[model samples]
Target: MQVDVAILIIIYAYVTTLVVLWFLMKVRPKFPSGISIGIVVFLGIATTMAVVTILEFAIAPVGRPASRVISIARGLKIAAIEETMKLIVAALGILIAKNEAKWVDTKLSLAFVSGFTFGITEALFYVARNSYSLFGLVNLFLSRLIHPVFTVSLVGGILLFRYGKRIEGVLVASYSYLGHALLDHYLTACACYISSAVILLALASFAGAVYLLMPKIEAERKQRGEFEKEATVELKDHWLNKM
Candidate 1:
């Protein structure tokens, strides 16, 4: 079958850009002012895409002829690298928020935004290459979903950080990387039906996990707000009593 690799690549590029942007708008209301957010988004996307591309090139040679098996291994390696980079970004976001005494939502949202921006830039670059056929395009589409799925894992890592267990955060980040790699390797190397089915299942699982996590994150944000307010009130009263 002459795989319409181009179509698949386009689909992936479109879907990933849409999902990441949608998530950013939905999760982060106070996303800077005007020019700053746009600039940050553009830079984030460019930087991440460059990093991913370099990583892919570096790892591709290890696979030699790029047979199905080797391609699968390469895909996994790329996934691991992408996820790891996203995780590091997420961790840095969390650490910054903690130091600044910012809300947890802000930290989580920033981390996801960085990831989404990264995905969008990568998608555009891949589509621009015009390298794939129908089958290749389909492969690209399926592969693109991994970005958001792995990004959700980064969110989970941020939550672990909120709970004051940085180790748990690291573990969550590593899990995201492994999950991404496993998914990519299997889908790229297996039979078409098997690969498509597994990708669908993974998407469903990712959606469900995100749904479950949202309420918990909201609750935590509210609780933190209350605690902050109470502490502020106590400080005010202490100052008044001293006066």
Candidate 2:
């Protein structure tokens, strides 16, 4: 149960991000229901692990040392599993947000918060199982970032889909999946493919996408505000008339 500095940093990052998300959700006006947050968290963990495990077992022959054919097959399997998990998580997050309507903003925030929680928990498990070295800690830090980043991207897509652009949401989700898969592939080959240029490019792409979508997100917030005001008036009227 030895804890490395990198692991400590990752845990701190995850917790700090989550606390900020919580504060934002609370101070920003409206937020999702308790039930909705629970559902998103549950699906995030269940869907990702289920898909990863299934792909691992299905491609066992490919992962075997003796068969080059099997090795190639396993690689493809791993890629597919990773990409699919990203896409599914993103899509599901958006879908949940859509269902919650006015709570889309809070739901999106919670989705990423939940994702960070899952990533940190999984990293702890991985470090516990493996050797706890500086390298292992760095690996955990990078791996932990994966979940939050992917989730954030997915939440962005979901917000777009809820507003007026379903296609944009799908595109964002797809990009997140591909981006995650590429990052994972690169990291898996870090020993040989330690190219800072490539890593920076990928990070830039993700950051750029998020930046581009900020305005739309702000617009959505305004819309949610209007919806909340209308709902409050309606509720007040209904109760007054009943009284």
Winning model by lDDT: 1
**Candidate 1, 16-44: lDDT as tens digits:** 45554555554542333344345446656
Give the alpha carbon lDDT tens digit for every residue of 16-56 in model 2: 34544543553352435666556666766676556544543
RMSD of 1: 6.8
- All candidates' lDDT scores? 0.55, 0.52
Error of 1 at 13 (Å): 8.9
Evaluate residue 78 in candidate 1 and report its C-alpha lDDT on the 0 to 100 scale. 74
lDDT of model number 2: 0.52
Query: Which ranges in model 2 have alpha carbons more than 4 Å from their true place?
Result: 1-31, 51-76, 89-98, 101-107, 110-114, 133-142, 154-175, 191-195, 231-243
Candidates in order, TM-scores: namely 0.58, 0.59
